[model samples]
Target: MLAAMRTFELSPADRFTFAQRAAVLSAAYADYFVPLWVNAQQMEAMDQIYDVDARRSVVAHAGREPIGMALLSLRGPRGWISAVGVIPAWRRRGAARAMLRRLLENAAQLGLDEVWLEVIEENAPAAALYRELGFSAARELLTWRYPADGDLLPIPRELLQPAPVERALAHFAAWHGQPPSWQREEPTLRHLAARSSAYELWMEDALAGYCVVGERPDAISILDIGLNPDFGPVKAGRTLLQALAHRFRGRAFTMINVPADDDLSRALAALRFTVTIRQWEMRLPIIAR
Candidate 1:
């Protein structure tokens, strides 16, 4: 059986064709909770933003044809299993398990102490797989979206002004109550700054909050937003969103991985940004080689 002869190998981005990896990912995620599609260009961008380590990632093959791929991102002693997918037709044949085992081994080889990944709250099979591999659920993360059709309520122009990216990040630690997810980490935001824009909210001439957004081909993303603890979260959040809406009129917006209990989450709800999905961050300790 072809399934019996399946194999897995490291396919560094430099040595592998991203087009092939992107095709497998698109096919593998066809039935995902949210629609996801990517081309090689986006893959390359992700490679840079996510800090993907080519040598540690894995590709699964069934008799020499690519069936799945997994990417690993390294940050000092930690590893992030950023993406994993096996094409639909080849699922249930141990491809995912084999690929993950290879990735864990790779992590061990690199002296990483832990590896992290996220699974949709409703994805039992994937969650079970992670648990079986010694992962533990960490925390809940929420995805929020606001449609572009609604009236853009006017914000006080003097209170909300365009900001340089560095200015927007000036109060990052004071603004967010919890550490951001891997994608929104300071380093990643800096990596994406070239393609993103920012806005700062002022209260009585004092900087109260700020937000960074990057326009995707489909919708604008609220990459990061933070409010000074001295200000009311809802008011600060509302002003930020209104300013953003006015600046990028007619573009829908999405914010991913906000902590479930975050004030930002509440602020988004108050403004009618519906929850699109919920996910659980998971982590596994890796035994060094």
Candidate 2:
């Protein structure tokens, strides 16, 4: 007979070590071969963005061996499902369902207004599970990427002047044609301030386009870029991509979760950036029970 499954919360005293947590996630995603895997340090950095609470993140065990886990983030009334996974050996068990139900209950208890997450567009089973749990499609997000080919030199830096990081961040929020997806929100960029910077190219001192980039130990990630929507996407897109390529030339970068059909997306494509991945942002309104 299979051992009885039980769950427990993470804690500040470090009841569950970071290595242990990383191991569970790595095993849960062991079959995936692309983009390498997330290490303990990377997980730590990511957890900070969600304001992860140990008491709220759940770990499941079948007789002391971890079989599944659900990591949650609580920011005000917004609860984000940062990640959820079950080890291969434990697949088809009810652990994922049980853990999510527990997580939603926890969120409701805290009086959260809503919960959110992203599911890969091709992951049908996972999407179905989230849908069954009351998640609705919020928006489609796309990841655009390009290798900084040494052969492709950037235009002179004089063409794109470095902008004040703080001021530009503010301008980005003000210029958004639509509300930004959670990962691309200003708060995320600010929280990651230690390793990030922003730049702007002006059409005579007013903002033409601007981009934010962050440098982690292992990844040089593009957070987001904002261009004047009034100028039209193709033109704004061209200017922004060229300016970005010039600024961060020779170093491959991946921009995460930009609106799929917007001007930015078109610009990335026109610049030959490839779609590395796509995800559906899903949301759940937490009605207190």
Candidate 3:
């Protein structure tokens, strides 16, 4: 029988210091599908990249123990539910729902025009919950992986030139075929450039594309890549990926949350990259535009 009045309680995450909140999130996501194990330092870095607003986020407590957390990131009139997770023992106990409800309430109070989030396609329960909260899937995002030993495509490196990360981002919107995910947005890319390498492609004296790569302990991620449509996105993307493969040989590569309908996926497929995970980008409109 269920215990009477036994339920998770919501608290403003800002009540805790950054390090304490990071520890809470780390524990909550310890057994997640992707299994993130970020320390306070890493969490701080992520907060900067995601524009997280701790004051607008929430933590779920069972008694005095933080058993779950949900982060909210605000960018102008838009708010993103960056993450929502609960410890294994606390699953299906109303923690996630409580945290999410609190975040939505916070966003609405902040006068956000819309709120966004992504849910792994295979996680039916999470998807359903977001839908129940009035979120609608806007698009499908794909995570692509390339094996370390995969055959590298034959492409000339003559036109590929090393460049400042800012140079690449200067043309981001113009070169990209579709809108980017929040993680790949311009502000996030700028923050990530401190730890990444950037390069650009030139075709007939014109800038054809740009690519930025960020290395992890076990893999190299394509943090951002943009191909000018006028120059043939697939062709330009192939050259860019080939350059990345040659530059970082013997390292597995991952590119997360690329829109499924993006033209760049063709180049990825041609270069032996395969989809590893699919996610749905969902949004809840709070204020009419």
Every candidate's lDDT = 0.83, 0.74, 0.85
Model 3 accuracy (lDDT, Cα): 0.85
- Estimated TM-score per prediction? 0.90, 0.86, 0.94
Query: Model 1 Cα displacement at 89 (Å)?
Result: 1.5
In angstroms, the error of model 1 at 98 is: 1.1
Q: Evaluate residue 70 in candidate 3 and report its C-alpha lDDT on the 0 to 100 scale.
A: 96
The candidate with the higher TM-score, 2 or 3, is 3
Off by over 4 Å in 3: 1-5, 157-159, 216-218
Instruction: Specify the highest-lDDT model's number.
Output: 3
RMSD of 1: 2.6
Question: How does candidate 2 fare on TM-score?
Answer: 0.86
TM-score of 3: 0.94
Instruction: Encode model 3's per-residue lDDT on 66-140: one tens digit a residue.
Output: 778899998999999998988777788787888898898998899999999999988899999999989999999
TM-score of 1: 0.90
lDDT of 3 at 255: 94
Better of 1 and 3 by TM-score: 3
Tens digits of per-residue lDDT, candidate 1, 1-289, equal 6456645444543456878778777878888887578999887888899999867788776655677888899889989999889877678888788888888988888889999999998899999999999999988999998887866667546445788898788778778888899998888888988888888878877888998988765579999998888888877887777777777778899999998988888888877889899999998988722
